[model samples]
Target: MGGLLLVAITGIALVVGISVGIGDLPIPLATTFSAVTNRMGWTAIELNRIHETVIWDYRLSRALVAVFCGAGLALSGAILQSLLRNPLAEPYVLGISAGASTGTVAVVILGLGAGTISLSAGAFAGAFAAFCFVALLSNGARGGPDRTILAGVAASQLFNAATSYIVTTAGNAQQARDVMFWLLGSFGGVRWPEFALVSVVVGFGLIACLLHARMLDAFAFGDETAASLGINVGRAKLALFALTAMMTATIVSMVGTIGFVGLVVPHAARFLVGPLHVRLLPACAFTGAIFMVLADIASRALIPQQVLPIGVVTALVGVPFFCLILYRYQRVS
Candidate 1:
């Protein structure tokens, strides 16, 4: 029943996204569908150039990007929360987003590199670095979820300070504006190749997390119980951590640090479906994808002739949702 519900929500989200894109122009639904069919070479119907550009080039790419980003972040959050046994655990909670932002900012401000090695590469490097630092700090000792969360908080603050300093010292208004936009996240420059890369990475991560769902459940009872069950807790944690970091890095590179989807979506899934990782993981993924698609549609259509940064739209939507979740959790407790 939960799976069916998730599928229904995702289907509705897709329809709404398509409608929003079509409504952006004077194009009717039939015309929009015809344009899409023409692009897919499914029919002899002809579409005007305006319909083609709006439907094929801009809206489709933006909507697909939102789906991927939302799924990736939500899945990442579910894994991290399970591994750390902390409700607040998320990709951004550990400074991965901040680190990625720092790397992207450096690339934009300094003109430091070229081609694929520029912004995306830099963001990946920074995210990996932050992951390693947090892992090192959390290793050994009685490092539970609380310790991990603390380590992530420290790392995130440090990275944010560095990124701020770099932006301010550059002192170029244009560069600052560029940095600001990237920091806030946008789906403006999404292309087929970029989407393909993100899809591959996110797919692998989702598989890894699902395969280890039992192990994650075991860990929820603590490391000793997992070890007693013949699960190598240490090895499992390391592998899951690496997978999450890689997936998060790929997304941060593409989207520039959208937040709260991971934090908010997983909790909402948990509220509806309970905390079995096997069920929760997939639920979170679908819910996240739907949430992000709606957010992206609003971002594009909320203002005419001006595209709002997707991250801003997500934060605006997510923060209030998050607060509501907290209140509900508190009431239950």
Candidate 2:
């Protein structure tokens, strides 16, 4: 019932988002849907070139990217929480976001925007490096969850310091502003080719993670119990770690460091559904998609003649909700 309700809410939210996109535009919802259907060859209806271009080229691409980014982050959070056995476990918890930001800043600061290798590539490299470092540290410690969490905290702080130094020393004002905005995150300025790349990476990663949901459920019981149940705990963890790193890197590369969707959405899903990975993972993905789409809408519509960063909107929404969840968890405990 809970899962069904979540799905229903997400569906409603998606519809609302589509309607919101039509705001202040000359396009009607029926016309928009007709344009989409005609494009997909479901019906033979003529669309004005302007309306078709607006719906197909700009609004649809942005909305879909928002959905993909939200779902990917939430799925990554679910996997991390299960693997670490920590409610607070998220991709950003281990300095991956900070590292990615630093690398992006490096690209902008050095004026390295030409060629196939851009700031996105640099961010991916940084995120992957940070993930590897944290994974090694987590594995080396016999102390388990606490040690892993501590290592992540330490890493996050170190990487943040590096990011700060780079921002302060940047020579050009435009470069500094660019780096700052990237760190804040946005879905604006994204093109179709970039969106397609992100979709492929996120889709593959989500499928891979869902395939191992059963192993994750076993791990939730405890490492010893998982081993007893014939699960190769170490191998499973390693594979998940790599998959998550790749996904996180891909997202951070494209969208910059949007935090809390991964951390907050998974916990919210777990609160509604139980700790069962099968139910929890899909619920988290759907809810996260809803959350981000709404956030993106709010970001665009909140101010007149100015667009806000999507990260700022998410942070505003996520921080209060996260605090509420923490309060409830403490009360229950």
Candidate 3:
């Protein structure tokens, strides 16, 4: 397990550095290291000023945000799967992503809040609204996971219809184009602020989830079993659901919706580290960070002079894994 962790960490570090080094104006791997060391005051090495600025000001922050986003989403998925006892559940299963789209559309297409509300803020508000709606429909803390998921499905359909109506009737070509790009996900505009916010959310969220690892294990046997085992089923589900929502909302607001990391990484990590959340959670985090960074890298590098959506890259990888899981499921059935 320790060796596996070391490998995951090393893989993350390596890809992160590579992400920093590859771009329109490529920097050497050595220069990327030099920039890091120099900034950290570990070395007084002279470097090209342009390289230093790009490395520090833009790419590094984007990569770090991707790291946190990936970890947060993956951690959220693990929690959802455990709490709901549904292997197919993921971060966006609660309609958070659809709510975010509606929020972005309201801001960008419908011209709500004018200049007062940033896209991220609007999206967060919309996401929270969706969560509240779900809670209400499902009877909040008293609701079962199955009920909550059903509420989420209804919410998703509603928000998605709203978003479609607005886009078709209101937004112009340029506005629609912008919203479409954002919906598919990008790390292009994310910088230090995004990195800082996501790191704090995901970092503390991971710690909180880790503390509840045992309860999550109890949850796997269903709510009644969990209740019989002295776990506060309602409270635990509510707390874990909120945590998952917050993490997912933050990431979606910052980078749009990057799918499949949450869906794919937790399953892959579980395969490697087993179902014990104590070890599985950290494994998911590390694998997610690596997978997202590498996806970001692939997004940039896959097409010459043009970047593909990060979601596309992730889906390319995730779809096969998804199919394999389904195949195994059918075989078991």
Most lDDT-accurate candidate = 3
Whole-model lDDT, candidate 1?
0.78
Task: In model 3, state the lDDT of residue 110.
Answer: 79
Worst 10 residues of 2 by lDDT: 15-24
Q: Candidate 1 regions off by >4 Å?
A: 1-26, 111-118, 136-144, 324-333
Backbone clashes for every candidate come to: 0, 0, 0
lDDT (tens digit, per residue) of candidate 3 on 52-166: 9999999999998999988988998899788767676675666777787678778877778978997767776777778778768978536765677788788888887888789
Off by over 4 Å in 3: 1-5, 107-121, 128-157
User: What is the model-wide C-alpha lDDT for candidate 2?
Assistant: 0.76
Measured with C-alpha atoms, the lDDT of residue 136 in candidate 1 is 78
**1-333 in candidate 2: lDDT tens per residue?**
676976656584555447335545656667777876787889988777887787777777777777778888899889988877777678877677777776666666655555456766777777777776776777743647667767777777877777778777864677668767877888776767777987897788778877998999988877887899898988988888777777777777777889888888998888888888888887887778787888887887799767788889888877787678667656766
TM-score of 1: 0.86
Candidate 1 per-residue lDDT, tens place, 1-333, comes to 766876766584555446445444756667766776677789978668887777776666666677778888999888887777677778888888888777777776765575546666787777877877787788733686667878888889988888889999974877777767877888777767777888788778778888998998898877788899999887998898777777777787777779888898998888888988888887887788788887777776799878889889988977787678657655766
Task: Report lDDT (CA) for all predictions.
Answer: 0.78, 0.76, 0.83
RMSD of each: 3.1, 3.3, 2.9
Segments of candidate 2 deviating more than 4 angstroms: 1-13, 16-26, 111-121, 133-147, 167-171, 328-333
